[model samples]
Target chain A: MALWRVPLDAEQIDVTLGIVHIIKERCKGCGYCIEFCPKEVLEFSKEFNQKGYHPPRVKKPDDCVNCHYCEIICPEFAIYSIEAEQEQANP
Target chain B: MTIAQEAIREATSHPLDDLLRTERIPHIWCPGCGIGTAFSSCLIAMKESGIDLEKTVMVSGIGCSGRGAGYVKLDSYHTTHGRAIPFATGMKLANTDLNVVVFSGDGDLFAIGGNHFIHAARRNVDITVVCVNNFNYGMTGGQAAATTPHLAKTTTTPLGNPESPFNLPLLAYAAGASYVARWTTLHARDLTTAIQEALANPGFSFVEVLAPCPINYGRRNKEKPLDTLRLFQDKSIIKNNAHPTELDVDWEKGVVLGTFVNNPRPCSTDMYDKTCRLEEKPEKKTAA
Candidate 1:
């Protein structure tokens, strides 16, 4: 497929973004998320999912811009992003 | 402990999860089939259109593409073969508030459902149609259909298809579709944009999506899944508002893709209501 990074302008980027959740079994191993990630933050894991497909793994989590291109291009809807929880200050 | 492990901790959540029939996941479509992409584009369009999901209904006829109705978590109907248009038309006329969309294949739309296609456009039915054209009957083992290109090899045309394929954009434009466009599965953004526009249009709007049937159509023609996509990327030229007559798909040369028609016209419902009002007023005075 033609993998193009869809730029989302006018959207706030969550600087404290933690992780992109990947539903292992649901990933069809299309690699669309990895190919379309503008940050080059993802790679295919050596371990296979239940379907024997290699789901994407976060290679550089801190580089993520919180863009939803990976989530949108996932034909199986297996991947999504979430912001990290704030660290509690000392009492 | 690891980033991969952390990411896989929870099932990925998406806004479209509720919009899909998840139980039908790992859908029946073969790997690399373009229907999923086309269907996703439609869902994105519907979501972006800001239409009331509760008041929208998707109607589809029998084909590989027809399976879309079953997958979309909407008031969708997998109607009889080649009847998606008429079924959606009835839904629209029964409740004008509902946004009726007909999603089906080229064989279902232009072969058996062809008469309905012409009549629906001629009547200016208020509906959006997404026709996924894979060039052959994928469901029925790749038989040659009305849209199969001339000299293409299909199961039904073992030597070569001697018949000329219908120029779909021209056909739809000539048939009186108010908004007409064609896109490939490779052009997801363009397809989604056109679909969004078609959904918002007032009268009959048709969007033809050229998709890949990698298993049935591709293997027979020596095109693997990615190779099929390469064809689309290499051969497509976008020309918005180009005349339909110039938008023919020639595999050797290239295919022109664009939103060819977007002129608004009075829909059937609007005309019917106006005619009824005129006759009702005249008949009341005569009776009095």
Candidate 2:
């Protein structure tokens, strides 16, 4: 790696995996992901959770990285990272 | 072609059909991986460009997103971790006739390759870039990437991220990208159109597709593919006579998504192309 030699034609990643997960049921419609992700990935949704709180929704799935931070920090363990890609790769 | 028709075209290409790069099949990407979408968009852009496929080359770095060059059958240079841009640049400067495109990731671009991203945008090279922005590093397990959300959990950050993220479009626009547009994979047709426009537009055209990485980073955020798709449909704001602050605008159901930037004063590569003192730069002088 050149340490720093990105070309003009580099792919512009619009969606990516991030570090946080939001528990829809316990989200309380807090715009944390929207306010947090540097890439502007998360957004608030109209749908409410079991507690009648509108949870934060991921607007970009293709960009997520399953960091599991969203689950750990949430007061509620609503958001948790799963090994979706691992299954596809092995199976 | 319309998306439905495009699907037909997609079906026509039998598995392991035409040879462009290497004979790589069933690309080893995750199900619901945005990298696949980014790769497909690149093909759409190249097809729209009408550039000779034999004369075109694709480059990539390391990461789940870096596999583009190998997946699509084309003249691809699967380079090092984050040097895809430089590799593609070398290819272009050496042989301008060859359409050089780089497929990279947020971690590759924003983290390790950040400096390259700025310089390349400033140089205004003649190439079309399609970047997928998923907040974290998807390939090497989940980690806190440059684009990770603040106060979020990551493999590294057990508690939560205490930092902020980058505004990519603003960064690209400020860096002097000749053509810069933003869209999400949810808007597949519009995304294809943006890719087409970026490829056709001369100078450094950057199209950032907000894609989904349902497997790696998404699961951490509790986002399944269907839920993520619905989120895209809800959160996107269509491009029109929208307000500047409209970028920060929120919607009730889905987002108002559409083309944001199309044309602006282009920072021409004509000056550099002429200064290089070479015509069509000749392919691979000595072959690496």
Please provide, for model 1 over B62-177, each residue's C-alpha lDDT reduced to its tens digit, 9 standing for 90 to 100: 99999999999999999999999999998898788899999999999999999999999999999999999999999999999999888888999999899999999999999999
Tell me the deviation in Å of residue B162 in model 1.
2.2
**Tens digit of lDDT per residue, candidate 2, span B1-288?**
245422321221222234323345445665556565566556655776677988877788888778777766787777787788777777777676777777778888778888777777878777767777777888888889887767656777778778876766667666777677777765555667777777766677777777777767678777876566567756776774333334432224433445555554443346654566487764435344
Q: lDDT (0-100) at residue B182 of candidate 2?
A: 72
TM-score of 1: 0.86
lDDT of 1 at B279: 48
**How high is the CA lDDT of each candidate model?**
0.84, 0.62
Clashing pairs in 1: none
State residue B274's C-alpha deviation in candidate 2, in Å. 4.9
Q: Please give me the total number of clashing residue pairs in predicted model 1.
A: 0
| lDDT of model 2 at position A88 | 40
